[model samples]
Target chain A: MRQILHILTQPNDPLAAKIIAAQRQEPDHQVRVADLTVPEADYHALLQEIFSSDSIEVW
Target chain B: MKPSWLLIITSDPRTSARPAEAIRIAAGVGTWKKADVSVYLRGPAVLALSEFADEFIDEDNYTRYFPIIGEFGRPIYVEQGAPRLAEIGESPMRYQEISDVELAALAARHNHVARF
Candidate 1:
């Protein structure tokens, strides 16, 4: 299944690391990680992409 | 540095950690940047000021950082008619009560405005 993981955290945050590890275990799921903490990240655009996907989980 | 900043946070910390984190970052940045920072809480965001805030989140402990932000002298305000104000008893931190009209006026006076 296509899944989008939207994480509103810094690049090096521990929570973000844990999320990346968890996503790796689900190899069958097509996952995209959007980090909102990045200065250049456009949250509205990312939200649009995530809402259009099959499934979305925010952290 | 900007003269003032208005950070309007409408997200409930119980539902997500982003709102609390946004408040923390905004307050810190505003303080360090020497701008007069004001936080306006509306909707569920008022919960961030409650003593029970720590119980809702397991990670990121955003409630703990709230006091540090307050120490910077950045004022935090809650909407006068926000429903969450009734849900969560007395606030642990200091905040002024402002009506929706006053919130708009506050925003208008600030040089920069951000919403989360």
Candidate 2:
């Protein structure tokens, strides 16, 4: 499965979120969200993992 | 050079000072740390493109550091969405309008991403 990273900054940007979820639902891809707009406590760790991973596709 | 910073210029002209500060940061960091810096024009930042030949020549003008973008071995990228700014028209550099998804991917490719 491909690990896709999405940095979502807009609450209005459902497309971005939906894409990530779709990827995750399918075995072909797994979506991880950074939730950049309102960075949560774990956002930094999530970002570090995604950025450090080579198999991750960021959007 | 390590990698480029996807600099976004989306602030108003009166608020151009904010971008100027960002430019200065790029110049200083690129010069000292050998950073590959790339400026991306988005939203209101597209206005910087049209200011190409204006008072941009002033050293005190924050734009003076813009040339440093190229000097430091970085490309000044413009958004393709901003139709008003064309290299031939008024904006000094070329622009590309990429999807927000693509922008995110770009930010991902870089080692560090900072927004201003």
> For this target, which candidate reaches the highest lDDT against the unseen true structure?
1
lDDT of 1 at B22: 76
User: Which DockQ-derived CAPRI band holds candidate 2?
Assistant: incorrect
Best model number under DockQ: 2
What are the per-residue Cα lDDT tens digits for candidate 1 across B33-112?
Answer: 67777787878888887766655553244555666668766567888877778777777688888865565445545554
The segments of candidate 2 whose C-alpha lies over 4 angstroms from its true place after superposition are A1-31, A36-40, A43-59, B1-3, B52-59, B86-89, B93-105
- Per-candidate count of clashing residue pairs (backbone under 3 Å): 0, 11
What lDDT tens digits, residue by residue, belong to model 2 across residues B8-98? 5555544456666767777777776555666666655666555453533232544576666557554566555665454335544444566
User: After best superposition, candidate 1 residue B68: deviation in angstroms?
Assistant: 2.0
Q: Which stretches of candidate 1 lie over 4 Å from their true place?
A: A1-59, B58-61
Q: Per-prediction DockQ scores? A: 0.02, 0.15
